[model samples]
Target: MAVGRPRTFDCDVALDHAMEVFWRHGYEGATIAQLTEAMGINPPSLYAAFGSKEGLLKAALDRYTERRAAWMEEVLSAPTAREVAERMLMGVAEKQTNPANPPGCLLVQGGIACGTGSASVPFELAARRAQTEEQLRDRFARAKEEGDLKPSADPAALARYVSAVSVGMGVMASSGADREALAQVAAVAIKAIEEQSAR
Candidate 1:
């Protein structure tokens, strides 16, 4: 008997599906069956294409990282540090509050769950966070150069602080915080960044 030709999977589409499944259910919660089903592929095909569930997740994260960079580019293009921070914080707040997105950042959610459970997860999570921080720092640095930020502002520290607040808001959203609560939290965070930049 001869083996039939296998159907080809669209790598990008499959990864997007995987990302959504993992984002919805989380790492420990999402099963291989769920991933494969959502991706419209079988176990053998999924494994053949991506090696393992973890491998697929890593690919999904890479996709997400690229998407984030694109978004950051838009956010950082604002005229002032306050505007940039507001743009990002408001965007996050909207997502966090939206019933559609369900308030979880994929990387942040995965990091929180996997960071403590596995050896490599924590490192990957840290790296992801570092990447985000670096982008924010760059934004802040540029704002300072344009006099949008005060001369005394510390871009590195501001970056760390803003990222922490953003991640914290995601956790809050996961914990059942409503849109009003998230908006309040976002406002406070953005205000703090602005006030500090002024000094």
Candidate 2:
């Protein structure tokens, strides 16, 4: 029996293109035509490789998370809780405003809005965001235990605040905020974290 033909396109390259399309346009906003065009593959190939649009998104998100792992590790390993916040906020400002990639984060822009058919998209993105928040919270808790943060400081609250600020910065970047503006926002956030440490 004759075997099927080989896939001509590189899966990694295709996924990267698909991810950028998804990042620029939310779940409901991205059309199959757009994804296929960006991936340089036909609809059948997409279905055969990834199963469905949602499946492709899951794969893309996994790729995105993998790319972020190193940065997250470095941020969490900061010598103090304040440094962690500083690194996180400042890093987000720079990343979101980088000219090389799309404005706004994939995690933030990928699922901010979805129709009933794609309702699970938001929850998927939320879970990922919550995971990041949990990591920061655990790091802050460790900092408090080590006396790097004041005894009165709330690790969970600080983590949530930082996460909220990061999310806000992504939104601002998507809305055309420049690096300088985001840097100023990050500066204010770092000052707040520093004040908490002094309390």
Candidate 3:
């Protein structure tokens, strides 16, 4: 029997690798050659699996959304909203400061690049932002219901604030902000929440 080539294609792994490349360099900045090289596959193989770079990015965005939602679920379900908020901020802080991973959020970096270059990507990014904001608002609403947040505070507003901070942190991380600085910024948010929740 003739020996066949070892199986090297794993769609999941390839998509993840592609995602990271797009995450680091954004869509327009990432060339097909770069993606293929990073994915360890030929152009034909990548195109066959992912259709095109845009298709691959959309799929990757879906994966990221699902993964982030799962993580948010865990954070939101904490015993107290204070714990939830702190943990959420801590997670962001760690991600920002972690040298092993990409410096900033893939969506935010891509959105910035895309908004200036293409019309469609901005809408795509907006939809993603809306989804994320909804998820965050749900968590904040739960916290409010549990009396972990001030009765007078608006869950939507708080969620928006948290989201804003997260985006800022992503930018700061890309700009080489230190862990201590991230933690300090996170602490400010946490403190504000604590004060309100205490009311």
lDDT of 3 by residue, 34-101 (tens): 99999899998777777877888888888777778877777777776567778888888997678877
Candidate lDDT (C-alpha), each: 0.80, 0.93, 0.79
Task: Please give the distance, in angstroms, between residue 184's alpha carbon in candidate 1 and its true position after superposition.
Answer: 0.7
Candidate 1 per-residue C-alpha lDDT over 1-199 given as tens digits, one digit per residue, 9 for 90 to 100: 9997766888898888888887787776778999999999889998888887677778888988887787778887887778778888878778766776646587777655553445576567678878888988998888788777888889999989888888887888888887678778879888888886654
Tell me, by lDDT, which candidate is best.
Answer: 2
Models 1 onward score TM values of: 0.88, 0.96, 0.87
Tens digits of per-residue lDDT for model 2, 118-168: 899999999999999999999999989988889999999999999999999
Best by TM-score: 2
Q: Candidate 1 versus the native: TM-score?
A: 0.88
Cα RMSD, each candidate? 3.0, 1.5, 3.5
- The reply for model 1, stretches above 4 Å from the true place, is 1-7, 115-117
